[model samples]
Target: MSLLTALEDGVAVLTLNRPEVHNAFDDALIAALTRAYESAIADPAVRAILLAANGASFCSGGDLNWMRRMAGYSHDENLADAEKLGRLMQIIDTAPKPTLARVHGSAFAGAIGLIACSDIAVAVPEAEFAVTEVRIGLIPAVISPYLVRAMGVRQARRYFLTAERFSAEAARTLGLIHEVVPAADLDTAIARHLKALKAASPAALKATKALVAAVDQPLSEAVIADTARRIADQRASADGREGLSAFLEKRKPNWGQA
Candidate 1:
């Protein structure tokens, strides 16, 4: 299988298994990833989704063979192919459960979209990132929305146009990832985040994810009203009441029990 899916202690782990090619995006891998992500998101037992790869490089972007095949594709064929990749990115971006990327080595071209779509991304200090579509006489069209959202329009414009490789530190500075840890401590970092996430009420986490997306737009009367309604709805939820009672009673809340 090009992708491996496993559920471990509430985290749905999706591992890119194509180490030989640095887990490049072939059509099969793309389809497998899309299905895995969809499955993870829809599984009620899954509290978080983790994207990882077993290789020296995370993902080097489009597979050469796939690109070669695409070279001879008609306009409609290419459009369909791009849509599949775009849908995969969209699923990760809008997952109700928390989504994280565990990155190492190099992440180029389309791989950047996977990282950008994640709610939290942790990369090794040696990890590298690039938007290299322009270098190949193509644009980073499908992943543009997520990339722009993650890194901001200014940084996106520069990287998209220049297609320059950037270090993990630079990626963090640009908001492409949340943290840069040494390779040796990558798993530890992931565990720490998972632990924190597990402590939160699942319903609250989902609601909060939705809240962030809702408020990411320009503030307005509708935005303010939506925020007020969300808070009110949360307060009235069973988990919300339990959370408050647990806090007052000096005990941990039963997160997913409600």
Candidate 2:
């Protein structure tokens, strides 16, 4: 299997299993990932997700073998192929559940997109990152939106043009990754994040994600009205009421008890 999945204690871990290729993506892997994500999203038991890999490198972007096949495709064929990748990124980015990336070694090209789509990313101090599409005479077109959002336009301009490799610390400083820790502490860091995520009401977490995405858009009068309506709706929700009641009673929320 190119992808591995496990659900435990409300956390679903999706592990890239193609270590021989440094977890490089191909059509099969892409399809598998889409399915895995869909399954996790549909399963109410899953409260959080961890995107991880089994290899020296997290993901090397595209598989060389797959690229060779794409080289022979016509323009239309390539466009269709690119669309599949875009859809995969969209699925990860729009997932309602809290998503985290367990990044180690190196994450390049499309792999960077996966990290960017994640709500939080944790990397080891020795990890490396790059937007390397330019070196092969190709552009990082598909992943550009999420990459720019995560790193900002200014940083994207420099790295996208240079395709230069950078350290994990540089990635964190640029806002692409949330935390950098020693290799030995990677799991500990991820666990901490999972613990925090699991403590929140699942419904509220989903609404919160949507809230942020909506706020990031141009704030027109209609958008402002919609935001106000959403908060009001949440305030009347069962989970919301229980949360407030729990706080006043000096007890843990129902969601946290699980």
Alpha-carbon runs more than 4 Å astray in model 1: 218-258
Tens-digit per-residue lDDT, 17-67, candidate 1: 999999998999989999999888888899999999998999999887776
Candidate 1, pairs of clashing residues = none
Q: Across residues 192-245, which tens digit of lDDT does each residue of candidate 2 receive?
A: 999999999999999999999888872243433343344334334455445545
What TM-score, computed on C-alpha atoms, does each candidate reach? 0.83, 0.84
Report lDDT (CA) for all predictions.
Answer: 0.82, 0.82
Full-model lDDT, candidate 1: 0.82
Q: Which parts of model 2 have CA positions greater than 4 angstroms off?
A: 218-258
